[model samples]
Target: MAATAATLALDVASCLSHRWSWLLFALPLLGVASIGLFRLLKLPLGVQPGSVVEDVRNDDRVPPALAPAALVGTFFTVLGGGSAGATATSLAMASSAASGLGRAFGLAPRGAKAHRLVHRGWTAACGMAAACSALYGAPLAGTLFALELVRFDGAVARRLPILLGASFVAWLVAMPLAGGYALPAAAAPDPSWQVAALCVLVGLACAAAGTVFGWALRALRRAFVRSPAHPALVVAAGGAVVSVLVFAFGWQRFEGSGLTLVYAAFDGTSEPFDFAVKALLTTVTLGFGFKGGEVMPSLCIGALLGASFAALLGVDPSFAAAMGSVAFFAAAARCPLAAVLLAAETFGWAVAPWAALAVFPAYMGSTDVGMFGRGLTGRLSRAKRTARDKRRREKER
Candidate 1:
């Protein structure tokens, strides 16, 4: 139910954004107004998926107003042509709804606080799975995503069946309402040794690009945080810059979620610098306090990057683009399993092996901390600490 409701609301917002898309002249004004609204309501500028996942992992309470605030803020941001995606907003909404339902049903029975926290975490993970399933139209990938988000543990393992069921049910409900997000079908390329070697190179390049993107985003976010200017003024300046980029610099193609650019890449119509330009626009949009998620923009960047590489390597553009899309996202989000599953689901199983070849290298090569606030290095460090603590406790005993 939570997933269905959030999907409906997001679809409506998307439709309204498309309907008013011709009002390009009003973009700056809308951007300013959108930030102003968030400020007035005392809401966070961006309800990032990473933050929400972290909150769930820590068993933090979801404030009652946050879900609705995210939805409204996302609506205004999208309507204003912010270079962002709605996936995080939907995730926030659905997770909050699930939290509320859990509280209502007393799923956290009278027991140790740890038990209640675990139950809360389970519900939140289920909600995340449901939302991802609806948005991506791949239940297994969505389930894996939620599992990855929470850093799969023994407790989560026990709840896997519940999470899987919720994800499929949400997809079923969402299919009739908003339809699955289907990309343009591309022909599978022959998996030759040469293609596999080039795929490794593509993966390395995408990992480098992903690292640069993450660094730039964090730097810009720091600058925004340290700026002494009023929030509205800062946001308005960002809007003006976006306006200049679109109208003056002829970068109108990089606006919104950049899904059009994704399609263009598959059609072999993308420019050489489409990935770089889209990355810059997305960083500025989010760093300047525009509300939305980075998932779609990351996919767009990956598609463009892959398509450009295809031209240089003489490989199939569609296949390369598809590989790039999943590989880059895997590096950026630190979710190789989910990315691999997503590739299999969206492009067919034939592309899965090649995607894995690309994805694992990208995951290993990426130097950035990742958009999710941590990476494999952090996880390893935490595990080491846990082991050390356990050994110390045993010695004391």
Candidate 2:
């Protein structure tokens, strides 16, 4: 409910922001640093804010005040035309709600040993499910998404009902406000072995794109971190670079969430280069410390990529876009099941079987680094460390 309301508020802010272009310059400049102004000293405007990436891997209990701070920050970020989408903000706010509630009521279960899995995990999962359901208008996928994320935690299984109820409630509340997504009539690919095989190839292509996306992100991370300048300075520089890219390359197609362009791809409006431009701008925004999630951007990229090359793959554009949409996210997130189900809910079940083919290859070949850092990369490293620790213990014994 809170997530939905905040999003609506953000929408209004975005609508109002267009009337005053100077806000674009003023907001991003003040962004995180303005938090410093709260104190009398007026320190170098360096009191930074928080986001999903910072809290998801940390304390199970988050401060209550985080919710308001994030909500206001997101509104301004979107208003400023920063290339961020809503996923990160939703997750962060959800974390705050969950953490705050747990701490407020002293709801610790199974002691500190299970802090991450019990008190924090349950709340975060429900919060995210509700937020996602509100954004995507698919209750099943939204619920499944949150459950899938916490599969590693055994405690979540017994509390599944609570998560489901919360998610459904969120969907119901958000439905009227979001109104849902609807694409115009377009050609659909007939079910056939040839088409399925082509989808497999499309998935492979998306995985390749994921690889390049990962590389660019790493390169930029290295460049930005290696620099000695203040983070705010780097972020401002990044904002400037994104603005130049948008104007210089005529990449208005890459603005906002890029969902409009994604919808247009199915109808042959967005061109092939739209994917490249959107990806570049999105990575730039993230690298520079903007607040947003990568899910929408990934979907946009996949849709454009699939539509552009569908004819080359000898398939229908709509079908290709559908395949591209799921496969790209699956590859990037390394969650084939969630990716396939998300498509099933969005595009219908028929695409799932075919999308599975693309999803499998992409999952296997996609970059180890994922959008939210919740992929096999971290799991594998953790597993390896555990094994190495076991060996060391044995040697000591």
Candidate 3:
């Protein structure tokens, strides 16, 4: 159902972008309005858990805004060349709906509030796993992802069964509805020291890119975030800037999730300029308070980088791209295990070692801050890190 919903939304956006090219002009207004309206309604925005779940006044009760906020990612991002991935969007929406399921299902109000809240969290976890599995078509990765996202809560062991059940059912349901490109896979290459060594280099390069992207993104967000301001104005201004960039570039390519470029990278049809441009556009989209997750954009960037550098690495373009995308994305999200599994599961079992070639180093190389604001924790911006380092240095002195 989640996959179907996203496909339908994407299809609609594709039609609109093609049929009424001028609707692109209205995206800035729409982007700004979406933020203002959702805030006015106290919706969660659902792009990040910090934006929703953390806002619940009562720690025990689910936030009233979770359900509505989940929808915001889909609606806000699909309307134009905007950033955010279906994976995060689906997870947010499903988790939220699950959180509210107790009230709808009337699952025994006889239980204590704490018990009910526990049930809701468990349910949300399951929904999150299922939604991601459906979107990514990798059940284990999806399940682990859900668990990893909420690992900080420390209830992982108790809720394991519930998450597994929910993810299994969701994955089964999604098999039919998910109708599009699957992650490409390959068999592990002949084991070679050279391959292992190259993997390290790949990881380092991708990590460097992730670090730059992270820092640049933080810098941009700081300009608007550090002030008392009307969000709509800020978002609208950002949207307008994005609109101008899109028009000037004459490529809606930077808009949306930017996933197609992954395939294009494998096929050698991609332009050298795509990675940087997409990164800039995505940073702008999110920096201005445009709502959505950063995974898709990150994946696109990884694909572009890997493919572009395949010749230099003396590897097959497809193979290099496969490693690059996995490593880069893993670094971007700071999830080496997830990245390895994702690469192995999506492309081929053969890609695991090579994927690791990139994944581990990428993780080690990238900063502690990730694309999703440290995976469910408060953001630690570059400035914050610098300031902290400075204070530590003074103490040492």
Candidate 4:
């Protein structure tokens, strides 16, 4: 059995080594184009209408000209109160572009076999690199995210090489973007064991915040589907509410992706309430019709809340903010592995263990309900069916 397994692994590795897989190259182009297109279309319209373009040019999934929608959505998220980012949409586009490009090639076997082996792999690689580069200011996090989140078969040996190659290529492409990423120039944590412990507590708080965020999105979905409110109006209302809350709390930190606020939270730059309020605003923003990505804003909120908790605990704000960012991401995305990698990549080795440690409770405390639907355990369709069955049984009784 051992020999057979080794042989199989070798076979898989050999197959993966083939350069016949040229689809990976197409991924970055799609990613850059998709994001660009999402921005371009929206710029002229002055409104974000998120939709997939059915038209195509060659193998490209999202043309640069049509990427304005995603950008506009992101703008609303930052300037307004929409609680989303470029990651989700970009992932979707990457997957679509891969599949579309694969179909155009017509070189592989048709049907499910081709789709599974080629298109899926290509798209997965693209998403991996995009997520890694965008989240941690490099391609590593996105690669890990794609491998961990999308690739379920652990024993599949060939996946690693593809992932590494994709990540490297993406990093190379992004190197022009202000030396990869321009992290906020901020003070380092003062030496204190107490600061580390505070990070753990901040992690816990982030877990709680994740739960609240989950519940808020759920509530919004319920109301939106059930209510007579217009979708655009509902989204607009949420934005207005966020504006009002920002004014009331004097927390501009709550606005947009909250990156600036997140940086400030490191040194107690913003009030704790500011973080809490931004969390509320993002949840409400996304709960309505505003479409974007949720990761960045959530990071900002978690950092602020964590810093506040650290202050309350008499620990370092910087440490707390760092922990909060990772913990909340883990809880919200249900991707602890990705979250830790993001933390490590974002802050380097200094905080990797702490980030990993915080992810557990944050996962535990998080209710699993996220923008994707439910918590980590079940699919949305399955959960809905289960709920329906329970209702039926109750009615029969």
For every model shown, what is its TM-score relative to the native structure?
A: 0.90, 0.85, 0.84, 0.70
Q: Give the TM-score of candidate 3.
A: 0.84
Model 2: clashing residue pairs? Answer: none
* Per-residue lDDT of candidate 1, residues 253-317 (tens digit): 67667777888988888988889999998988887776677877898899899889888888878
> What's the CA RMSD for each of the models?
3.0, 3.8, 5.3, 13.1
Q: Write the per-residue lDDT of candidate 2 for residues 1-397, one digit (tens) a residue.
A: 6666666666665566567655556545744542332222332222122224334334345555556655665665666666656655666677668756765666554365445455455666677677767777667777776665554355654677877787788878777776333332334467787787777787888999987876776566666657688766777787777767655765654666666777788877677777888888878876666555567778888888888877776677887887788788877766677787777777777667777887888877787666555565567788899999999999999
Clash-forming residue pairs, model 1: none
Indicate the residue-level lDDT of 43 in model 2: 26
Q: Enumerate residue pairs that collide in model 3.
A: 82-256, 183-346, 184-347, 185-347, 185-348, 186-347, 186-348, 187-350, 188-350
1 against 3, candidate with superior TM-score: 1
For candidate 2, the clash count comes to 0
Model 2, position 51, has a per-residue lDDT of 27
lDDT against the true structure, each candidate: 0.77, 0.66, 0.67, 0.55
lDDT (Cα, tens digit) per residue for candidate 4, span 176-205: 543222444223355567766676677777
- Residue 344 CA error for candidate 1 (Å)? 0.5
**Candidate 3: what lDDT?**
0.67
Worst 10 residues of 1 by lDDT: 108-117
